[model samples]
Target: MNKTRILDVKYALTQILYFASFSALMGYASVYLLGQGVSNSLIGTTLALVSIIAVFTQPMAASAVDKKVIKLQSLVNIILIGTVILSLCLYFFELPTMMLLCVFVGIVTFMMTVQPLFNSMAFLFEKYGIQINYGLARGLGSAAYALASAVLGYLVEDFGTGVIPLFYIIGNILLIIVVYTYVVPKNQQHLVQHEQQNKEETEQKQLSFFQFCALYKKFMIFVVGVVLVFFTHTIINNFFIQVITPIGGTESQMGIAVFIAAIVELPAMAMFNIMRKKINCARLLKLSVVMFALKHLLTFLATNIFMIYVAQVLQIGAYAIFIPASVYYVNEVISKQDLVKGQSMVTVGITASGIIANFAGGILLDAVGVYHLLMIGVVVSVVGGLIVFGSIEKKKANVME
Candidate 1:
């Protein structure tokens, strides 16, 4: 193999392990919490707390990259090691069930938000003239998540719930090794470039909150639209198994559904990158929101496992179009200094909306069940579609000015 191909393969493998360690655990967490005898409300609250804290942590983590506090690979490796150790500690502590669950939740929450650090690293790689393809690396991770979730889901059916934690530990071990080895060493040239970029960004102009808000106007509206859509969809993301399993679907079936969803994401995301050159991303995003809105309404009416599976398949389009385009649009609209902060703001909005959705979703699930949650998703999704449509016109006006 050529040298470039080798690096790409290695980076992809590392990402696979990194996200496999994380996503597989997340795919089954709701089920795991249920097995541990936790209430839905408590689980939602735990997730909300974790995301709330992440609102603070992600920017700091990204800043560490800007400041050269640690090499990106080292930071990734340390976080993986920390995750594994903490997970093992929780497994062996023999504490009360609720306390043990809380500890596990906290650990996973912190580990999950290390996303921007990885993104910063990807950006750094591009800046350094490394032939790093972010989508392919990210795709491998998505694929790993599908494989792990499918396998573990079936295993849960046969071996029972006791094996879940063991799977988490095993995945993290693989993740740690990948992060520690194979990644390029930190180079001084890259650090100097990053520092220079940061300096120029700050020197240009300082933005007050109001100034930031003004600069953020159209993009912020788009992000807020995304947040509403995210809030709606999080209900499905978090509670899909709960919605389906009681309707004659088994754990294996749920796993298969999740596997299908993640697998569909691969090609969808891949095609999106290709399509970006041919289509205006904003138009694609508007169409995606429309499709997403339809999916939720379809989900609300779905009564069988087959229909739920179909709904999951439809979700791939929404994520593929909306997420990448939103980020690209935000980058186009914001100043260089605010790029990371701009992306982080989208994260904050999504997390904030998710907090509300998850808790309210739990209550909705209890009071009116999954159908009601699906109905709410349909409504919010339509709202998102409208915003996406409107943003195009608003964005044109801003550009014309």
Candidate 2:
């Protein structure tokens, strides 16, 4: 293989290793907490707190790259090692105290923001004639999630949820080694140039908040639509395990369910890459919006566990396409200097959506039940989809003008 291809492979492997364990932990950890006798409110609150902090931290993390505030690899190493230590420590703690332990772990892991950082790295690599394919690298993460999730499912079912802490310990250790040793090298050029450019831009442009809003108004509308879509989906994701457990699905089944969804993302994301060249992203996004709305609509009609399992195929269109497309599309409009802030805007939207989804989903589950909540998701998604559809047309009109 050529040099670029080789680097791409290495990059993909490192991300796969990094995200696989993390996704597994994310998909199953709440269940683990529940198994430990924690209440739903506590779990939701803990996750919300982490995401709220993460919303603030993402921009800071991206700023680290933009401003040369910290060594990128150093931050990853610290967070990874810190997560492992916290996991090991949690094993020694008792009931109510473990909730606090999860909270601490969430804070550290939440701040371990790398997606935008990696995007910047990829952009830098393009300048070096070593272009890293983001989608392919990201697909490896999906594959890792599939494998790790399968293992976690069986482990959770056979051993108990207590094994989760051990899994976290092992996973983060592997992540630390892969990232510190392989993905990031001690190269100063990307960081130095990025810092200098950001410094120049800061000196040149100091727009007021209102001015900044006006500057990104088009992208902002897109973000708002995407956020609402995310809000509806989080209703499903945040409570999926809780919804399935009572249905007699084993931890392995839960694993398989998430595995199925994550694996489906590979082909779905590939489709987006092909379609991006042929069709407009806004149009593609509308298709995803429709798909998700249909998905929840169908879910409201599902009766058996198998029906719910099958309905998740809709996730391919819902998350995989919508997310990457939104990111790539927004990049088209924003200045290079504002890339991190733009990406952070996307993250902030997601964080805001997640908070509302979790709190609202919890209440809906308490009031009407999971299936009924699917009906609510259906309505919310339709509204979000319509907003995107209108925005797409308005953008097209602006271009013509």
* Number of the top lDDT candidate: 1
Q: After superposition, how far is residue 102 of candidate 2 from its true place, in Å?
A: 5.0
lDDT measured at residue 164 in model 1 versus the true structure, 0 to 100: 74
Which digits, one per residue and each the tens of the lDDT, describe model 1 over residues 58-131? 76765675666776677777777777776776556666766776677667765765666666666665666667
Number of clashes recorded per candidate = 0, 0
lDDT, each prediction: 0.73, 0.70
Model 2 agreement with the true structure over 217-304: per-residue lDDT tens digits = 8667767876787877787676777667556666787777777878888887777778888877767778888887876776566656
TM-score list, all predictions: 0.88, 0.84
Clashing pairs in 2: none
Q: Please give the TM-score that candidate 1 achieves against the real structure.
A: 0.88
- In TM-score terms, candidate 2 sits at 0.84
**Candidate 1 structure lDDT:** 0.73
